[model samples]
Target: MMQRNVGVVFGGVSPEHEVSIISALQAAAALDRARYRPVPIYIAKDGVWYTGDDRLLDPAAYRDLDRIRREATPVMLDPRSYRTLELVAAGGRRFARPARWSVDVLLLGLHGGPGENGGLQGLCEAFNVPYTGSGILGSALGMDKVLSKMLCRDQQIPIVDFVAFRESDWGYHEEAWLDRCEQELGYPVVVKPARLGSSIGISRAADRAALDAAIEEALRYDEKVVVERAVTALREINCSVLGDVHEAIPSVLEEPVRSAGQELLSFREKYLRGGGADGGKHARRPAKQPAGAEGMASLDRVIPAPLPPEKTAEIQALGVRIFQLFECSGVARIDFLMDGTTGQVYFNEINTIPGSFSFYLWEPTGVSFTDLTHRLIDLALKQHHDKNGRVRTYDVNLLSERSLQGLKGAKQRAG
Candidate 1:
């Protein structure tokens, strides 16, 4: 049996570049060699694509961007050929041409911006390639924090009250808008860019002065910004969901314990210090059994959580529901914020392509990363088959012999 060629694309012009590389390399290393051949495709910050042996499985090598570019062959998605990604190279002495490589599936590891926010998905659609993760609509919806929250509210998924405003609107009536935010959400609000991740442009404001500064900071990242009431004394719980829109399975919940003084998990805290001393890069572990009931014990968490069984079930069911609501396929990590005292969970956000692909969460459930990757590849192929089965074009010549005599008479009369 021939192994399917899987193109795992990662690294991009997003702030999450380093994290994406880590996630992609992990996936590439864990892919079952017997069932699939993992091809490393790197997208540089300059927007150039590359593929080759040198680009394989090592996060540290990416630090020297220029070196990687020189070593790897430039590649691009071939819009003309379905399920094919071409490698463009300078012509040899006798022939002035380029080379190409056809891939079976695209496993996207790029996070944020064009990668996670539908740009790449749109390209995949145009190229008729089966890529893992969400479709265009789901990717777009999931990336836009404001829109996703709106959808969640309509679907009765628990979400915090938020006010979304455009920069143009803020420019026109800054005072009026600020007044509305204060009146509606009050102080100590969380301000964030409408469509970014990794806590890039997220801030917590305890007062009007801070709120003003936070909004200014968020505007640098996006045109739209969302201001929401901060969950004081909150516990952040994350759950990974697998499968497609129709049916999904939830991983055990993880409680990201932050420092006592930290109001929110900043980018520095999440990727820098490693969620704290007991929960950094090497210190981190995956979730385990009894399902969501145990919380995330091994990985600096309580596993299944210390919450009641009913609460655990509610969070798990909501996780699956949110996955379907966003029309997400493959795998995604949906984060929730629970009031420490009340134990009420609110939909926080969804990571379409979570870091490390959330394999650690699945490991506890007896699913290895290799098996998880295979499942994603299988799902992608199944979706491709289902799409191909649909009739996309019809054999009709509408312009062949249209009678214009009657239409001309009608037009003349109208004139």
Candidate 2:
């Protein structure tokens, strides 16, 4: 009914920082101005948070970080107030106090690092702010590849055989770790950082040499690494689930198109290429559009993935299960690795805050980007209300004068 200000928080000190920017800007562009006013809350790579005018909505304007910082107003979240962001003083305000702004809800567009890995979500909780997407536990669990697989395994959800190890486990014992991998999971393994997405630190290892190299690369991004037996004749199918654990729905399936000889979808293939052309009307682009302007929307993929009706339903059901399992709110894209040779599907990983919010997949389902954004904001507000409705504090004061006198008497008796 009434207009609400939604703070679209994005950008972070992460390998996927640029991708986050693209996703956030797309979401800001799609917000229904009639129902919600989109506020830009940008977290720079340096970890400083900023807020600014319409310049924040221009994707091209992000090429120069220094210019953005110069023009943007740096701000910090004040947990003392409900959803208040206080401006940090830069120039002499002389006698004037710093300004503050409030948002009805926070639309999280962050991808990796603290932004999506529970840190920002926790900050929102501390600020008592309503935010979209997963909560602290859900975000933490979804970001962790090892934990996601373990939970899936415990639940009997099919997952590829994986050997998870921390950097400490391989310290000066590379031979032992190599032997373990060679014995348990043989060659042609996929190595990935345990907590990162956008395929930033992922590689396919064919031999011991490549495996070693892959592990080292993965360690650069995260202390933990996951080496899984590569699915033969792999077909990556993704399904996006929207809403919360209580009531959620799955969108149409998507099979991301990979390039020939590309063992895994590199960051380039995922974002750099022009994919909007194949994405239907909302994803269609101009002939002279900039490279990678579409973000994940630009990645070439088949929507409603030419799967049999049964298979489509199976994947969608699985997607919903995984979404509820992770206690995820808002929209998340659950990826499944299907063995083309056997048609066996294995739960791969979950994107808690998927790029472009997987709008392409939902578009065919009759959910426009604007409508999707609206749903997410509404969900955020409802969740906040539900969370705060419960009793959080006690009326009794433990440190009252009577209680203090009793403590003093106990001390005297002990003496």
For this target, which candidate reaches the highest TM-score against the unseen true structure?
2
**TM-scores of all candidate predictions against the true structure:** 0.89, 0.92
Top lDDT hit: 2
In Å, residue 193's CA in model 2 sits off its true spot by 1.0
TM-score of decoy 2: 0.92
Off by over 4 Å in 2: 83-98, 275-292, 403-415
Error of 1 at 362 (Å): 0.6
> Which residue pairs in candidate 2 collide?
275-298
Q: In model 1, which regions exceed 4 Å deviation? A: 90-98, 274-304, 399-415
lDDT of each model, Cα atoms only? 0.79, 0.85
Tell how far residue 69 is off in model 2, in angstroms. 1.2
- In model 2, the worst 10-residue window by lDDT is 89-98
